[model samples]
Target: MARYFKYKSTADVMADAQSLGHELALADDLSPLFRPVTIGGRKAGNRLLVQPMEGCDGTLDGRPDELTFRRYQRFGGGGAKVIWGEATAICDEVRANTRQLLMAEHTLTGLEQMRRVTRAAHRAECGDDGDLLVGLQLTHSGRYSVRKPLLAMHDPLLDPLIVDKSTGRRVDASYSLLSDDDLKRIEDQFVVAARRAAHLGYDFIDLKQCHRYLLSELLAAKNRPGEYGGCLENRTRLIRNVIGRIRSEVPGLLIATRMNCYDGIPYRGVGEGENFIGQPCPHELPLVAAFGTNPHDHREEDLTEPLQVARDLRDWGVSLINVTLGNPYGNPHVIRPAEFPPIDGYYPPEHPLLGVLRHFRVARQIQAAVPEIPIVGSGYSWLQDFAPQAAAANIAAGHVALAGFGRATLSHPDFARTLQTEGRLNRKQVCRTFSYCTGLMRAKDHPLGQFPTGCPPFDKEVYGPIWKEVEQRT
Candidate 1:
């Protein structure tokens, strides 16, 4: 059991971070969280942003379904200034899930309607919509690509772990890696998507280069040959090129990037059969390859390259840079600070607070290095009721411009509103980091096709029956 399960107050959480050799402060007041701020040339109503947490519930033709509309409606009305939309695929085949939204000619009108719903919800809840900035994340799930996995460059770290979750068996197959010509086509598709996003009235578009996706994987492509591989410049060519075209063609929409500033190497089990699990101290040795880390010592980060990437993005005219770490597919604990592991996830190798500290410190480092650029920080969902205090402290300290939440919002979408009006969180409504959302999604898609994802066990009324059936079977 986690030590935090017994912690009862905000001070206890802060003390735990300090006892672990990491410092996290509690807010004296909630003013910092409610203060208005500006990013990418537009002013925001407050400093909180709803991080892109995808709900795999879109229609077959890539349009937002009722579930999708409800999720963003809560985000818009919940008082977060920036509603950072979830990852929507540029093309249908490259989607991460069967129901992942896609940006296309047929989906434009529906996408527009989704945005209108958000705006109306915001106006109704907050009395104004001028300060809310909504954006869409465009991505191609590289190794975890939907229907068929499309990898940029294969490596031993991630390839061997690919499994057919339905049977809990490792898949053995030689998958085709995407070529440079294929990358060029993908880049063009992104440019086209940006054009449509602009027309649909999205304030910005997050050219997502994170989470070991296609563009992010290219950043670690040291082995592949040709113009789109090798050096950092070549690796970033696709995103930079896409940005240039979007500026030339669309011009009106702003650009932002949700980038993975650091990647802790992949870890695998070192034991036998069904008992196999992640090595307890896997970071003892360096990683094979990673971004923003010493190639020789993957456990040690060398932010020189990642900092330069931030500078380049700013130079290319990006408004805000949202920072995250690790690949959730291979390294869930790093990206999300969870108490219990999901159905297919590994037991957390260390205390979950370590993951939270790593992200906080990384965001501080980036903010200090590029003081001119604005940054949105992740990993606050694990903070529970104390999230507002911790987020306020960081924002007040200038470590991060906005404190973002993912799973926390899925369970408690009214958190921001409650915090704004009541000045504290409703403890009963806060996420406990049970990771049931992830477990529910996996259960729904193990063999593919099921209910839309929300907080199944916590939200209860709508998802409780499905959770019960899943619990009975497993």
Candidate 2:
């Protein structure tokens, strides 16, 4: 039933790309992916990084639950030198979902245990953990917060999409925006979380600024007045302030960020049943509610400010950067190219290969601009069995410093090891871009309000039953 990804070989994939008027790169020699890269004076074992893939399996009080420990243990042994931890809430009130992890004093022991288990697993599998770099991504969910819709700035297009759980109604003009004072308090929380991460011996802490979360949304608040809005300088004020404080207070701790290079306009499914296709929402332009997007044409990328932000982040002491595209909530295809959509999602408007190419091109621009800093490129999971070849090609061409995998890692944790030892991924385990993990994420009818997401097809033992449950409920 899939329209794309019918290629039997890498050559076939490339030929299809050519037919689509895009050049898809593939390298038979994958050595470029095995080279060690320096980040904050520390050497990661290789250029492969496990992008922060949230499990959403934490406890009610914000501690890593049993499944959380298991997921990280697998990732630890999975062979990626840099295991970027999942997004952990800065405070309880800002959690994106009920089961989202929280980094705080009460949960410090649980976090330490999670790290300990991950490292132990890595050592058990790889024989040593000296070259491993583990980090925790700290975040504030903002408009997506489960408690309520917390706004940084109002967007006519996105505001109507946010249904405040507390009121069970979409937010309107009357919904209060986060005040300057509120942001100051949130900034302090970020610092505190970073300090906690350092105290717990995390290799680094990620200041999450992607996916239209609080900080990401702030980047597009050009029309809003005050310190955290308007011009680029003001728009990036909160992140800049948080980075400065973390550097001053937690001196030796390294800082990283997963930032959005482009935030495309929101889309909605327009057709019936299986025939549904994504269609852009009606909106007036010049679009002022998005970052790295052309105001006159919301669909086209204008990375001038995004490039500058990368440069500024480098100068501001961020050791490395992860470049991502689109707001997952608004435009899933741009962020994650998939063959099939999630249960509540729409078919991708363009070819998934084109979406993957967009990631490579935008990431190449950022990597070139900040040549001194390592840039982790995303959107590779859609490549399926050929992801490694594509990653190698990108690294060889100097398009990106590291190749990050999210859904791929969930399906095959030992992807790096397999590539190094066998030179190919286990085809049986490669994620097919079916969006089964995403379907589990969208299933919120559980007693705890979320189903732990993993590869329901490949990781069948744990997630298979969960998927069955979701099917029954939905």
Candidate 3:
């Protein structure tokens, strides 16, 4: 493999990571990191993953968009190995955000669009490495949403975004309690979506078991207070049931998850003292959304209990795990600084709830203890940093491997090629645009002009009128 001198004597690799455009690869060694892997026979190229972001880019009524297609297609254009689709609502009634990707096909046209996404990946122009593989993230938002009313693991307070069908005014937090039958119906819908995805030809499925989605909330004590709560077994039942069904039903799909508890083991928490956000290690917390305010003081291997549970789940047959730390609904200010993007409303720093750091050890510990399952380390990171030093840090800490930059990969798809070879990364400029983009993105499909949204272009069109509206109204 071709070699480049390591960033020596405080040489700023981060700067070199910028200015990436023409060249695609940095060195041959970084090639393996970008090549496809034969997973259960199907190829998931490169270790890079396009981390899912909720976008109303899809029609609110549940249809795919050309924008959605092109968005991911660009990531494919950038050449990530596994591309995660925008979170698609399993049930139209249970959407986490109004702008979520809806899998429910209200019409033949809807199915056609989804099919296009699948077909594009297989097209040769996407890359010589073979089209990037696609994976769908199915979510059932339980409580932690700013969206409309919906069903959940437990009844949720009316999400602030709920539009009162009767009065057309905002409603208070209302929990549309779900029953056993309703739960069954929703579960069936998820199955139907998975079946539909398999039918449409997605390579893998990510059961949105992390964050505060229905699966995680159900697994979290928030949803199942009594018999189904407290114990890890009770919490995991929701995910296991989903996995079991998908494995049994979807003949062509592979299943994976982002989780807090591996099995039934309630391991120790990661303290703020040991790990915090931004700083890479030791100071890093847990996986994003996995860190709780109360941290566990246990050493990596101390959790023999959960190790067995992880063993059971793997035995149950989950192939990979995306690790982040923090309770889905607990707190947002923990991981990175609160006003992370430091602008209006953009990608806030990975929430403390996102547990952006727990993977430092939990990932490797799981690898050491379970050792069989593929552990994906995530929480918004730099992939080019995976240069031997970062890779070794990951192994020493316990992450089986790296899940390269989410936005960076989005911006610079050829990150691996550029960083390793040219000693730089050809990145998309808007990445640091952060909250400017994230806030709007987080808002999903709602009309713009709500915030003094950034973007130099906005100065020309909407910002003036928006302020005029505000001034006149006020």
Candidate 4:
């Protein structure tokens, strides 16, 4: 495998970027990352954000388990002011995994307790939770739903990639699509989930519309007939309705969306083991089943629709927008520029730095398009310890309002706190983007059908044995 993270210092990283003819925004003064930012009339203590990351450790009945509470407690004390909670299923049937957190009346108390534990931890470490903005991301897994493939619409490219657990065969044209009424029911569930989140004292709720989930797939449902497909207006009808209903019903709750600006075509790994390289699946021109992608050339991004969606979301009362790229199940490299691919993934077709630049460029475009709303930027974890510098630079440049961290947070939950006290991240604890967490996420041989994900390399006490078992099995 080709190793990319060889920089010994930030200066070296800058020099490498310079040699690649890409100018990376790196600030010596990281104050931009510490500045307070307002989202939905509420002020976050800092520009640092903990991006929603699922541990897949909830109880089978969809309640937060011990590991779930532990993950949130660490994030709470980690110093990020905006805590974007992980994807929680709006109902039991739509869960992506058996243990995916489900927001329902039966599990509301555990969810509430989980939030309390997080806030308490934050108060204990940071001395107060006044400026803390905690939120939950409500979603329907759609095609990835663990119970079965609950598809919004069928795509020739994506269909073959989905394996039906019952038949142990890839999904074909015979697979049914979710009806309009089904979608409406899902939208209603989102409002119900929003109410539950508000009742639990969550400052905001993210209508999860990213990573090819039901809502995200709907955004690309141009070929599907009816009210929730074809034209952009039709495609966004469900989410817009959900937002309007939440505004009418749950008056005080803030609405947000972790949206996909690009949904590139699926890819497959070729060759064996260490030699595997990623290549896009066969696709025809004008790829109709994807959002924010250049129809003529699926490899490139076309943000016209995404930009319009952002403006619409803002006008419709969306308080914050977390900008992300590519579906993790298909184009993982585009969403996460990692040094090493996950066990099921392939070596990146492009340089990891190039992937990082793509994220910066795309986010800059979206942020520039919608300057009114706060945009949380992703794809920074691969930068390792220098992520804060890049985040500060992006903030200083007005490219993004908040710097969001995902895998990095799993490894170094106290990154923000360390930056505040020590002025830098602990290099030893910084995420190298090995994708071990993702590896765990993909491992389904466990008793619960999914393994909890954490930084096994650093948080060895908890995940080390788990990682060992995964390695042995794989």
Candidate 5:
């Protein structure tokens, strides 16, 4: 029942969506996706934005090495107007992976060179990049931090899921939570990082607050007692203050956020049939501990706070808000609808279509409420060849300002180009959603492994043998 991608027709996709109690619509003409958009006085040539997906292959000093530069060049030449640069660490201590890119004074030169090549590639392939809006995502991995699982708030749902790399077992350790003073320093760090990005000529900076990151975790800090916790104003003070600083300091630089409107807990229960078809057991945990969740009944979603947050961000003069859901660390299927799970992932609790629908439905709600702010809608990669159809429909209907792709970009960097020129995606180049890229990443965290990430099958020269080796070990 979960293998919805096996059906090869749009009719089958629609029928499956109906079976899952949702509606999936598509546009006949995808011109809306190629339309230009303006944000914070900056213009993007097209509505196709690349999602900020980390390669975990940067230099040890956190600079964009050869692999990183090549990936961005492909993305630029591929015709996506907005190249949402992958998450770069604001501070070295909070780096997600050993090789995660870092935005710092020392590494600025490498980053600048990388951007030059990317824009050069864009001009060489797409003719011009005058309207191109390239942004850098500033992030602190928070509880998911590899260097130190830094915490602003203790999450009931996610705490148990943290496995110690040494033991490979779930054991809670007293990793220090950031004090209010520490939070202030981190806020300063973000501002400093933004200044660097502006100097590097990044069109925008995405203050990433999604997928259970530090900022997102702080939003769920209802239990913590401090000036930066308890109430909504207190909880969001960090991001608000950080943005306020950037706005005051960096005059015309665009600001955006990849925010999670909903954060869901991982499902745990007995498998259904021989094929594990039915839904997993309901998550019985109380949801008040998490942001954008019902306090009265934890299982249900309450978007009141999330919407208010959006409105507040709009008031803060944010240009774009990339709408996504769930923590990839804990609930990846919610954010990415994969037919096959990652190496250390779970069977999808629902149809991939339902997963895709959740993103658009939530995005539509936010778009209607915050009409002033343009939004980049996620979860379309699961649509495969039909992604452009669905994305264009949403864009034309005024549901979202742009259609974002991540995993699909890894396999087919030329997807947006093909979609624009041929009016359809090359079926062979479309991501089959093998999730081998994610598998390679997960493999890195297992005991002793360091595998470079990319679409193993598509990028066979390097990651192909690594994928085979890792597959055999697993």
Candidate 6:
């Protein structure tokens, strides 16, 4: 719903929203960052971060491109405790787009390249004040792949993504029940890739459990009366098993998982397999939506997974918990606190301020529940002015926003540095003028034109040609 302004005072805004039963999020001191928090018993320098985002500039074989290396190198140098690798698939079939990075085949060589380069660069920069901990985010694109059609947990009900076909426009996805072997192979690949990451000097491997990915599918499998479905245990078994195997494979490395509190739908079990994009299906699987065996009912326990998963993995001595709102396209409302899309999204008034503000509200709730665990957060990162608000959510003042603006960060890799020094706040950075960064995904022909995806416009025009050269595989 659109927020109205009759020129209410800040006090009035607080009172009216409070009287209406909306919760108030506390604003904390972002400067102190975090109290000493340890993951796998190792300290994470400061509470700052470089949360996992989709970095698509890998080589054809999945290696990090030169642009990819330089991008993180600067980010690492600028200073962040942890740097999350873009979502890299465990298998070729699970990649979201044919051009996306993978764990199998060509990716190993590329990852080896990334591991060596990033570690060396990060070391040269942060030094003793911090160690750049690298975490690999393993993901499966499922039905939303920008490539040819492939199997998803649900029936192929959604239309394929529009793309210039090698011939005509080819269907960009496929759907079917993954065999036991399929599940095993993907799991094995995760272990191998995670082990490889550890071998190459990365400190951790983050298993993606949020958004509509493969593990999320298992977490959301509804009502199937089988060993792999229906009950929560059945649904989460794959994640558990994968975790166990990876624990053994990369015993010395830290393991982390990002989880969603809910898929934001009532009665929608584990996401109906996410078959469509704009409006078809969650295709073939269910997603974690609060606490019914499916999405039919919300349970308090269901909402507590971040802590529970943290505890469960803690038993295995795993690492941190990175939290985020997963739905951007399927449920923009998740990020936007409005009863409807805000006007700022259109041109001038479309920012959905209330919705974005609400993300902090959710983060605060999660923090209250698990005060001791190291939690990484997003949804309003570019609002550097929200220093106190970010601290209120328990994120350190030094923390950097993961996906704050499509291009805002590009112009300021030191976005967090500025906030740390310049010091101001803008918790409501979403002014209806901003559109979601939907245009930057795997588009063809024009890699990305004048628009910014998740960073500010590059300050150095020379960086473009340099980046293009890096993207060209050696």
TM-score of each: 0.93, 0.99, 0.69, 0.98, 0.94, 0.73
| Residue range 1-474, candidate 3, lDDT tens digits | 112223442233333333321111223244445445455556665666666644455665767665566565555555456666657777766765555667766723564456455446535334444535667777776553435444343322223434544356554434444554656676787788888877776777777766555665554453445444556676566667767898888865877666554211122223343232232123223321121222243112234534555676788777766654433223322212222432222233233222323434455566676566666655444233433334334534435544535444434544544554664444333233233334443332225312222222222243345334433553
* Per-residue accuracy of model 6 over 233-300 as CA lDDT, tens digit each: 67677778888988776678888877664554321212122221122234333433332123333211
Clashes per model (N, Cα, C within 3 A):
0, 0, 54, 0, 1, 61
Per-residue error at 105 for model 3, in Å? 2.4
Off by over 4 Å in 4: none
Candidate 3 residues lying further than 4 Å off, grouped into runs, are 1-32, 107-126, 129-131, 145-177, 222-227, 261-309, 327-330, 333-339, 342-359, 382-398, 402-404, 413-423, 427-430, 444-474
Question: In candidate 5, which residue pairs get closer than 3 Å at backbone N, Cα or C atoms, i.e. clash?
Answer: 287-298
Off by over 4 Å in 1: 163-175, 268-277, 280-286, 444-450
Best by lDDT: 2
Candidate 5 has its poorest 10 consecutive residues by lDDT at 273-282
Query: Model 1, range 55-78, lDDT digits (tens) per residue?
Result: 877887789998899888888888
lDDT of 2: 0.93
* Candidate 5 lDDT: 0.83
TM-score of 4: 0.98
Q: Candidate 2 — worst ten consecutive residues by lDDT sum? A: 1-10
Residue lDDT tens for model 2, 23-123 = 88899899998898899999998999999999989998899999999999999998989999999999999999899999888999999999999999999
Q: Higher lDDT: candidate 3 or 6?
A: 6
- 312 Cα displacement, candidate 4 (Å): 0.4
- Write candidate 4's Cα lDDT for 1-474 as tens digits: 788888878788888888889998688899988899989899899999999999999999999999999999999999999999999999998999988999998999999998998899999999989999999999999999988899888898999988988678789988889999998888889999999899999999999899998889999999899999899999999999999999999998999999999999988999988779999998888787989999998878999999999999999999999999888899899888889998778999888998888888888998998899999999999999889999999999999999999999999999999998899999889999989999999999998888988999999999999999988887
Give the winner by lDDT: 4 or 5: 4
Model 5 lDDT per residue over 286-332, tens place:
55466776765643567888899999999997989999898776777
**Which scores better on TM-score, 1 or 6?**
1
Ranking of all predicted structures according to lDDT, beginning with the best and ending with the worst: 2, 4, 5, 1, 6, 3
Error of 6 at 448 (Å): 12
- Clash total of candidate 6: 61
